[model samples]
Target chain A: MNRVKSKYLKGKEKFAIGIDLGGTNIKIALVSKAGAIRNYLKIPTNTQQGKEATITRIKQGIYQIISQSNLETRSISGIGIGAPGPLDFQKGIIHFAPNLPGWEEVPLAEIIKEEFKIAVKVENDANVAAWGEKTFGIAQGVDELVCLTLGTGIGGGLIIGGKIYHGKNNVAGEAGHIVVNKDGPLCNCGNFGCLEAYSSASGIKNRVSRRIKELKISDPSIFYQNNFDQISLVKIFEQAREGNPIVKDIVEEAIEYLGIGITTLVNLLNPEMVVLVGGITNEGDKLLNPVKDIVFHRAMRYHVADLKIVFGKLGEYAGVAGAAALLWDFD
Target chain B: MNRVKSKYLKGKEKFAIGIDLGGTNIKIALVSKAGAIRNYLKIPTNTQQGKEATITRIKQGIYQIISQSNLETRSISGIGIGAPGPLDFQKGIIHFAPNLPGWEEVPLAEIIKEEFKIAVKVENDANVAAWGEKTFGIAQGVDELVCLTLGTGIGGGLIIGGKIYHGKNNVAGEAGHIVVNKDGPLCNCGNFGCLEAYSSASGIKNRVSRRIKELKISDPSIFYQNNFDQISLVKIFEQAREGNPIVKDIVEEAIEYLGIGITTLVNLLNPEMVVLVGGITNEGDKLLNPVKDIVFHRAMRYHVADLKIVFGKLGEYAGVAGAAALLWDFD
Candidate 1:
């Protein structure tokens, strides 16, 4: 038999290259079919070096991972990338992400495929994370799943009937934009009263900054610093745990709005599991318990009966893992 | 070949029996494969007379339609039922419905199949309506569809990836209960500020009545009557069109909230079309225009780019047509 016939005939060529392209860092990994990270590497993106340099760096990273792991290039099942988007997955184009400045319709997949002489796939960052969780993390074996990446801004990913549901135009799963309060506050998406405005990290900090001014609590050293811009989520949570009044209400409201937003998702999608990922998940049970209580209490009775709301097990590796999984069949 | 061998050997055996179970009436029809209603039957439910009577009436109606249409029992595809839910579409059991009193775990499909000796399917009413629209009505050929039944209550049916999405347990499409204004008004589902409270027929009437009491508009004959309970939606819309204060704000708010609720759905589900159905559709452009305006301007740009927001074309026959379509494989 020819080498091409051994693609899966021998059934041991079970590795894939996964790449997570972030504004600050690029994470690349050599992952096995069973989801083990055989080799991993992280490098600074240094986006200021421009798109070409970033592309060159990614190619170098891919080579480094393969060589360090001592794996043959043919034994690998190509490369998969997860990046910030409004990008086209089918075309593998980056259609100008907010964080990835100057990236306008760059076909990253084609570039990588040309270098590697193998398959290459690219997906939205949030979707990649959700896929990672569904494939090998907390949501393993769960068909209907929702993954929320709560970082600087909230992002949502949906898995329906065990398949990634990239709406009609690949623009579905805008869960963070669900309007929880129709007239509450402005969101980054230019809408008012979005769930993101109330629950996201940026929104929480902005709320605190605005509330500090509105309430005229200038001496905010109890929780925040003299500089409103210096207010970190960690300090805010610490103060809330200590019952510092300035931070308590804001933290509690964030939790409440997050709960309400999640309840809306639970009611709408009726997913088997909701996996929480990103910075906000670090708060752990403090953030998760109340959100669960509200969803269980507020969502339709049948939806909550067997539903699970938990943190994603993959953590930072989700982007890399899920991106790599793009080349693998879901089974 | 025996008679059974002709199931699909001859495509001419294309008739299906459809039964729409409602609080006021049971609509039964003999529908052909080409979306034509060969014979239609309507009967008053007289729900006060109880379940057995209703089921018998349904059976009698089915027999009448088949006889009237001159369709042979063997030629008919099967029987399909559309009923108020949370019903088990798979097991064909109705857990209970708010309108269908005392219908506890009724094995509707099993009961029908036992008598008829053919395939029988029971589905949630909203799902049936959505399926009907997808199969033979306004949403024909539209893959991602959202159908709204706007009557005493607002109901939602979803067609995701071209099939009716029943969520995890078939209790998925409760569009009416979407909490638009988290603090708006009390809904029948024991929730506050649900879209149903702001947009449903009963909710609209209730809002006007409460506003009359709150604002002390005792002389409501300019639109509503002295008997606050008789404040009909038709009168309310007419007065609102004429710019009457008592009815104008309430009507405008209803449309606005409905728009906002739908905008939320568009953002989340990214449906290609949203078909509005039921009594409120009588207002036509007056209702469709403002709702469309809000959704178009407020939802994510890509979601609205090619989205079609139109009135359901099936009219009163939607329930019957949709229920009947359950026995046919969706193209």
Candidate 2:
């Protein structure tokens, strides 16, 4: 009786509170029955205060959001959370999240349920974003999709057959760890040639640095006009946009690696859509077009024939929305 | 209703006929409620006679299985078939089977249902094998598994969350087409560096042929004791078992490629178990041990922490058993 059953929802409308637990901050939102955010609040996570104090802060944030919005507590049916992963999603326990120290086997959902007196569900952050995409964003109406969150580290979400696919250990859809090249580069995950090691923000930065160093070594005068120490993804993209050949080549190389990784997913999963979510989306066609070219030309014809490679529609709110989207399973 | 409802089978002792339709032959079996084969028979496919003739042969095979077993026709409640892909399993239609020429969008399940007056299900051969493995093979009790069939070509089956994972276009689980090496050999599927191109039977043959040619050019005296013109996978394994250094190197090289491919699967899927099927299994420990070594050493540690790599238990009859295992979905 703890879990909501589908048969109970004959005609009733229900709303849920969504919590996005990140390393720096926590974002809480009152998601309506129609998946619209009626109220939102942001607060620093302050994990240094320890687990009990952090839980207290989250509960306070929830109460504040409800009081500020003047909404009745009875109106909220459940609570959903999206948190850093490698956790036991089914058990709603944080099984040693790297970003959240001292959060080993933390019974998050159980505690939240106790505090709110409502059903609570917890999922991986990347998977929550994917659920948000499938329910309200670009992947709407798509039964199968692979969403990649390109940032300092790449995160993946696999929506297969209209549901988040949690494999044996709730570790499925680890596309970032997929090896693009057998002997390319070493990853922090202690693997060689992983997709994240080549296509992530840091990966791109490293590539650009290598290219700049090579160019500087060959012709020091070429880089004297620009601030070489200001090396970053934004700077590299800006330089590439201005037709800097070295920066452009670096961008192209990273795109090729991303395309290879995506192509691998296309061949293995054959998803209907592949949505890219992150700061990289700002480059638009410069990143998407070439990645699409390599994926289409490299993957099996039938798989890529109708596959849509697009940017995520939810943007920054994807995590919050996707966290709320978790209730869709019960609703 | 064309499909049987689970509720309708509350008290019925239902049985099913399982058929594995391959390019050269058809395997038919009467499967009981316990995933056991009661009666079995095999017949040549003779696909050249056209689709209608092939259907007739399949129908005849079914009748033979029933009549020979002296079983009541009413006892068999349904029929299931495992056919080559990439077919529309949901619709029971063959999109285009390269092996079974002339089969294009063929309504196989409906045709068989009409003839037998029973519910029928059709699935991809690799998927059927995966289901069979889940039901009665090494993957029993495992919720997530990846089954790889290595023969003339490589075929894959993805069992995620204890169910067959059919992505958007029913073309998922094409693990054979995964790019292991970006600039390796070309595959018949019109892609370069595919797992199939390096780990398949023909791929091994090509590698052995190249190794033989290289050895011959360097020193013909080593090959004077054996025939160099005849080269095959069977020959390579046989020679390697006798401590032939050249053949041992080729076998090891192929195993290295297989390891990389399996490592990729491990990192992406994080399956609880990986069941490898085909002639390669005949090599047994020679192949399994080395592949396990590389996968454990190369893949992410947490992903491969408790991974199980084993051979399919059903052997050549896996296709037929898998075909029968399709009924477990309904049961």
Candidate 3:
């Protein structure tokens, strides 16, 4: 949120426009080469307005940030976008995104480039978040790392050899789909016992809701008038801490499964660190400590020797900042 | 098994000694720069005689292989040993292998180097197998791959960017320990529901033995006159195919869990290929077809788009050849 320029950006100033295109909102920021945000703007995606309107909204968000900074598009290094994936990063096309409906093979980069006459790079949200963490956040200078976005659904970004590891088909880091309990609940992806099925915000809430009904708990005050969907994970975690029966078991299991999934990743990849980000991280140490304990205890002795499991430092700015960071080289 | 030297191994022939130090035996080979085994030797390890005796045995095997090839130790490029892990590749120390009891932090590389005055590298067996597949076996030319050794126990070796990825602690490719059926069975590793507990040779045989007793099937010929340990996995698979009740469910579940484990790997790493090796691979297409079907159908569409799940080409030579392969560069 700081507009203060870094003293290290002493020479001819460089800036890049970062766009975090989400299902609910479009976040745009004018970021310096040093990862400082000079101008920021947020606007509703209104996907109900259709793809063209959403694109227009993104353009407006970009234009709004640029105008706020009083900088010409030509002066910027480039525009980088972090969008929901199944993306063709090489071609700058989004093949399909789970969150965004009616978005199929959208040439986001080309459309944005045509409007601004600047080079554009589109990356997966998870990958961008990872890049953001690697470039400027907690995992900075971490060569081998896995950054997880723990929100409505879990997403993973793998940094192998200090670069985003895009698998053969550009959808490599799908950590959420990792089967923790093969006999566990079904995931949104139709896979049974995925990490997302156990630990994601939706997964936790789904179970909590089911358990609440099963136990016939009619406590409205405990659930904030039962508007559970609008409720924060922090509240649920607090309830678990306070010994609410339904929330406690469900939350403990979710955290345990999260730890198991992370343990699986650590065993397989043997990363130097794991950065946890997104909404669920709002629980902070309550989430990280337990997950860390599980991973540290369960993973092989050698793997956890120097493995650091912690939270992402960039917070909400990771997406926009990381998307923008894709344009600059990390020294 | 072919003693035929590659015609291209011309001019100045370079060789490296590969030692596969197993619990029961020490297999050593003189391998050429082109990944051809010029000479091979295998002798009993006799761990009961102590670690020093086993080391002497390894040395004898190496000497025999060198004598068979008529090559001086000085002429060898280097020696690479692929042994049961928790190995320190940098220091060439075996950090207490599970199979080879009493082999605790033995500096095998230093001991051998002092004796032979040649560079020595010690790597985890799984990693060597993976490197072997990538360098000279079925996964040759594949940059991203996961090589699985399904023998007495399941082991995984990952080849990322055409090199063995020794996670943070040189124990990264512990794919056998990946919890597939989290609620399934207890693993020898003290973990529950590991891939090894479900699909490894010992795992399958143990379940078969227990099931045979439980089912009260007194068919002596079906299990080779109650000598289950001496039986091959091919026999069990055949019995399963023949619709033998006790063997059928256990065998199917074993294959299914193996498929699930492979599917987990495919989903997590998004590797280009998966190579299956070791004793259990004797079932060949019977195993490969079912695994391929499961992975292709279960894993993400993009991941399975061009994924190749196949068997290792080096057969039993994979361990020795792969260990030797660690000494050379594949161009």
Question: What is the C-alpha DockQ of each candidate?
Answer: 0.66, 0.62, 0.64
Clashes of each: 0, 0, 0
Q: Compose the digit string of candidate 3's lDDT tens values, residues A171-279.
A: 8899988887767887887778888988999898788777777877776356543464465566678889999876888899999989888888987888999999999
lDDT of 1 at B64: 82
TM-score of chain A of each: 0.92, 0.86, 0.94
Highest lDDT against the true fold, candidate:
1
lDDT of 2 by residue, B1-331 (tens): 1233333245464567888888888999987666778788989999899888999999999888877655556556678899996888888999888888899899999998888787788998888888888887788888789999887788899987778988877888998888887787878888788888888887777776676677665643343335655455766677777888877766666788789888889888889999999887898898899999889998876688789999999877788787876765642
lDDT computed for candidate 3: 0.84
After superposition, candidate 1 runs with Cα above 4 Å error? A1-13, A213-230, B1-13, B221-229
Judging by DockQ, tell me the better candidate of 2 and 3: 3
Cα miss at A40, model 1 (Å)? 1.6
Off by over 4 Å in 3: A1-13, A72-74, A209-239, A242-247, B1-10, B209-235
Q: Which ten residues in a row have the lowest lDDT in candidate 3 chain B?
A: B1-10
Q: Model 3 chain A, poorest ten-residue lDDT window?
A: A1-10
Q: What is the lDDT of residue A120 in candidate 1?
A: 92
When sorted by DockQ, best at the front, the candidate numbers are 1, 3, 2
lDDT of 1 by residue, A136-212 (tens): 89999998999999988888888998988887878788888888887878988888888888888888888887877
Q: Which residue pairs does candidate 1 place in steric collision? A: none
Q: Which prediction has more favorable DockQ, 1 or 3? A: 1
Candidate 2 residues lying further than 4 Å off, grouped into runs, are: A1-15, A42-60, A111-118, A209-230, A240-249, A328-331, B1-14, B46-53, B209-230, B238-250, B328-331
